[model samples]
Target: MPEPLDAALTKVRELLLDPNLTRAVAAGRRRGQRPSVVRAELRPVVLKAGRRLQISTSDGSRPYTRNVAPGTEAGAAVDALLAEPFGNWHVETADATLQLRVTKSGEAQLHRAAADRAGAEPSGHDRTKDYLLDPGDPIFAEIGGSAAKRRQVDAFLRALAATLPDELSGPLRVVDLGCGNAYLTFAAYRYLAQRGVDVELVGVDVREDQRRRNTELAERLGWADRVSFVAGTIADAVVEPAPDLVLALHACDTATDEALARAVRWRSRWVLAAPCCHHDIAAQLRTRPAPPPYDLLTRQGILRERFADVLTDALRAGLLRLHGYRTEVVEFVDSRHTPRNLLIRARRTDGTATGQQRAEYRDLVDQWQVRPRLARLLTEDAPGG
Candidate 1:
């Protein structure tokens, strides 16, 4: 498979074709929930309005697309949203919200708009000048983002930064397990710092070669002051000033479990793990009796692989709850881009784990007839009360 694009172009014509990006911007901002917005050059899409179809700018003047569902509240929301003057419309569904921004673009044209705004004093650029394209800045190109998409990612990262604790903030200590090439660690450090968040980061991997190259890159980024690397197996190494946030991106199977073990032992406030390769649990699942209605799912290899993912994350979530952490298993990004799509963001809950939590976990494992790699590892040698 081709290397996944860390970001995508902001050209409206090109982006409209990517189903995942469309869904994300739409789902992100809708009525009655956090809003999702997108910025793009104008491209009017025509929609059938009963007997006649009208093609118009997303002026909100034309009614919502026919795909929009019906209901009193939905109708009211749509009407209210349309009254606003926007080249793009914000659509809010029951579970998703997206924004569409449409504008015309060109370099000289943008500068003209910015100059126009500056003349007004205490002013910002005219709407036409707000765009993702800025030939002057190359970071946008290197990072795979248009200025527009970078804004979206920035918003998401800032939100994530807020959700994690302060310990993960000030001189924010971080450890990235399996930090091959260290691109993400680089992104995180830059993202946080740009937002005035101070961070000290460490990238861990078994490959001495990768560590050497990454350390060189760190120095070049001027992060040599706060960032460094330790060469060895993640399990074998230990970090001083225990990290406030621990990330193990695509750590294979039991390796993911090991990453989690390290975070939990340190009792780190935040744990982010995008687990990859369910080969271990899939092996155990081979012999298990299928739960009643799920028996049919196991018959299909594709479905079985899918089931392994859900079952594994579910068990992992339950186990986290049992160990006093609040967890969310959410779409880290679109599945179309990566098979390892689910991100487990766990925050430590101060209270002790309740007996009910333990009982529920046991019940879930019994029903799945499979044990999670993390559960098996952590439960062993757990202190007897």
Candidate 2:
């Protein structure tokens, strides 16, 4: 109702129109108002014609999604949503994150942080952040295929930022289990280092050749001391002093379980994992009969495969919750770049799981008639197991 409130709404409109917008979330209904669609989200998508804004809303039961072309059409849609009784708004762009909260008196409080900043050359030229990585970056030149990889990195970093601790007093310790070529590994290190964070990063890969190559690359980049590599399996990787953050991108099948289990064992503060395939659950679904009424869910091979992916990640998040972690499953990238875009981001809550949580997890497994690899790993490693 005041300047802050009006200015905040104006900024929200500007964000909706900004081409660099990554994602925006509007949540929390104002007091005395009950909104059907409690949460609304906006993100960019690639279309055959051009880039469009994808709008998704949830009514606490199901989600409705649609896309609108960028420009006046998107602005109109955003105006309608902003006129709703939402009390909170969060926006992420290429350069920063902005949060606006409305108080009971209708006063808006706004906070802004430059989470992602562009780099500049000594010659007074700015290094363009096409995604998050500059196209002329040496890392891309070394790896090849800069455009797609940059988008993937940008998406992954967005998810990572959700779980990163706010109070970072000391150096951040990180481990990338099954890091393969370590594209995300290097990207994480570079991004954090740019933000003035002291990072000690380790990348673990099963292939000795990969470890050597990545280690060499780190040295060439003058990051040999901050970033290193080890040759080991995700479960067997020996990382001393543990890690504050764990990253496992596209670890195939149950290997994701190993990485997650290892992170729990280390009591890592944060974790971001993007799973590649769901063969373990898919294989089990093939042999087991689907639960009653839900049989149609698995009637087709393609549908069964897709359902297995959802079930696998849902179970994985449930297992993480059991181990004193608050977890969320989010889209790590636009589906156009890769279908394997779902990411499991978790933070250590250090709170015990309630009996109801355990029972619900068990019920889901029983109904599905399948055993999850993550469940076995967490159980076997628990105390008295």
Candidate 3:
């Protein structure tokens, strides 16, 4: 009923040896395995010495890569990986595609298909160098992270990179608010620095330990002169020379509001935030009745929480518009990696909100009778108030 494991392994070997093999990825770790490698990928590479097969493996957070001649120990290691009860194998060659899934009963199920006609080479970011955080970096190895964490960092960087304006002149000043652990802070510094952009980076958090540890990390990376950490609340953190870019990743609830308000106050050219926890609005919704014709919106606790998340972000985006900043709310990472993946990117623009935009924002707030923290923070001294 199923292909023999040896037969599947033989096919894998053939594919691995094929010069036309574009990419081969093995994922889903076997239970109770040593080294804890969760995923691996094989790709052909041409080195100065000669052609080699590059094997990249991720032990969850950290990624490592090595190359070896075909039919050597490295090749045997790749073959052994196929025999493991890894969940899935996806292989792509110039002419054919192979998909294999391992069943709980240790049987191999294989599927084959014609390779889709090649299109323009797919556009992609280099996972290692393009990101602020690289799994292959010494910092990641020191901190101990997985492939998934690396993906999250890459996703966030991709979004931020997309929002960056083309015009640039001088050193970029960046402030990371509520930068707990400062993983992304360090990453931002690395990304900008690698691009030959002069960067002045500061990470702000409430914890003194985090500040001290991040400061140490910066010193180790030889970035102490340019990148430093401070211990303070997002609202009170002091950044000198005013930041051109303000970043807040997963700042919880009203804290996110504080970060945005701080950015607006500084007139920062760019603001990127990934808000976490909609507790404040969710709490407010519990005490207030929903508007007519929309009572079903918050009928169930789960639905109420989800609605609060959307309402909170929508209001935040609207308020950004009201403040003359173009804004977008986008997914920061795959939902499987983290549910709190929404990123709000705002860029200062010459345009301001129209009368209708302001009226709609006001109406929504009035109808819901919920005062968003961001609105209150941004509009505390506005005309109506």
Best by the TM-score measure: 3
Q: Any idea how many clashes model 3 has?
A: 7
Per-residue lDDT of 77 in model 2: 89
Query: Higher-TM-score candidate among 1 and 2?
Result: 2
In model 2, which runs have C-alpha deviations exceeding 4 angstroms? 1-131, 381-385
lDDT score, residue 176, model 2?
Answer: 94
Question: lDDT tens string, model 1, 1-385?
Answer: 1111111112322333322221211111122222221111112222453221111212111112323322443344333333332233332222233334322221110110112223332322222223222212222322345544455344335436655654332456889887776666666765555344566788998999988998876543335556688887767665787887888877888888888877887787788888888877677777776889878988777788888878888788877777778988877656655567778888898668888888888888888777787877786774211
Model 2 local distance difference test score: 0.80
TM-score of the candidate numbered 3?
A: 0.66
lDDT of 3 by residue, 334-365 (tens): 99988998999999995978999999999999
lDDT of 1 at 210: 86
Cα lDDT tens digits for candidate 2, 262-327 = 899889989999998999999999998898999999999999999999999999999999999999
Q: Give candidate 1's error at residue 303 in angstroms.
A: 0.9
Ranking by TM-score: 3, 2, 1
Q: Which regions of candidate 3 deviate over 4 angstroms?
A: 1-134, 381-385
